[model samples]
Target: MKRALYQRLTELYNAYVDTFREADGKLPPMMELKRIHTAHVVANARLIAEGEGFDAETTHACDAAALLHDTGRYEQLKRYNTFRDADSVDHAVFSHDIVKEKGWLDGDPHRESILAAVLYHNRRDLPDGLDALTLAAAQTVRDADKLDIFRVLEHQITTTDWRHNSQAFWNLPTTARPNPVVLDDIRSGRPVAYQDIRSLADFVLIQVGWIRNGLAYATTRRLCAERGHLAFRRDFLHQLTDDPAVDELCQYAELPTQGVS
Candidate 1:
């Protein structure tokens, strides 16, 4: 019964995504990002449920929660370019509102919990009173989200398109010097300030920094290892150990793997 409803919700979500893409005409780069994120969330939820011994039915609910976790982010990004919860409005709150307004999670036993998870997924901390099921689902989704972000940044850096150039995507300043806080965060294993990033290189370093702290699941860590983020960590080691500024980043195409563990 619940599984069927989750399927319907997924179908609707995909339709909404398609419509959003068509209406926008030439989807933004982040659209690919959202798709990738949703996929990872779903996969991560499946892994978590399987490892935790969830039955087939229970696993389906976790998967549904993961799929819908970021549905609000699509609409939020459509209206605002930045993903910063503070710079614009909080995407999580907006996501909760959008899900309810659209009836995206209606009529499912897991609906309220899923909505709650989505609302707080990107938040600095989780709220109180979440039962074990909902809490696990939300944690899976968050870990999956961060894991994929690491993959995205690793891809961007390896491909040398860190600049995010062209009109379709925002021309992120990728060539500017790194900020002191950015370096400090990299060394201390903390979340980087989005505003402190001066160039694409710094942004890449910041993305890698997240793995050290925000990630929660072993599966996420395994996936990140497979993607070769450890190699990326090497650059941070050099930056923190030898030169904080990483003078002449152009000379180094790939970072060494020192700060990853």
Candidate 2:
């Protein structure tokens, strides 16, 4: 069943790629992002499920859910030309809507939960009362998604051309100082603010902070650590330790970490 599902998924992905290329007259802005990132999502999700000792059936659900999590981004971007979900409209909701409209998910064995997972994966918070299966798939996809963002950003920081598209995401100033949100998040061991991030370094750390908050599976965490982002964790902490603004944020939040050396 898993093998068959995988093959079908590959075919669907191939079609999505063809359609995407036709729409943009080129691949999406990032290099091999959709293809490589989707593969990472599936591979990480499978490792997460296997490490958690999930049944084969659950693993199948997770694999389908992870690969399809961003399935709507292609259509959404083709229409809107931007990846900001809130600005273009919620991509997750758009994904669910498009899947129904196009009947792309019709008759798939894991269709219902895969749709549910894709719909809920990028939410600011998980919905109340999610069933175990749905919740597991959602969390798996979220972790895998964030992990791949870390990889993409890590690559961007080193590659000049990658940084060009990345810097344009929020229009960071070339002369901007370090983003204070980066300092505060590290001090509190939380994720950084999304909107105010203003540099390649800040971008990379925010991606790192996702592990500090979004990770749901031990396998996901272990893989992130193995990727050497664990040290980046300390880099943020070091920023917090020295920055007064970060100390102030801690105090304002009344978090215990605030004001402590």
Cα error, residue 18 of model 1, in Å, equals 3.1
Q: Going through the candidates in order, what is the number of backbone clashes in each?
A: 7, 0
TM-score of each: 0.73, 0.77
Off by over 4 Å in 1: 21-33, 55-58, 81-87, 163-180, 186-190, 199-201, 233-261
Which is the leading candidate under TM-score?
A: 2
User: What digit string (tens of lDDT, one per residue) describes model 2 on residues 1-261?
Assistant: 677876787687667667767455777665247667888888888888887788877777788888777777777777887777766878788777766676666767667877898898887678889877877878878877887776765565456543245453355543344576675675566646676676654654554445555577767777777886645534543443454543343233332222111
**What does the lDDT read for residue 214 in candidate 1?**
55
Per-candidate Cα lDDT values, in order, are 0.65, 0.67
- Give the CA lDDT, 0 to 100, for residue 63 in model 2: 87
* Distance from true location, Cα of 115 in model 1, Å: 0.7
Residue 184 miss distance in model 2 (angstroms): 3.4
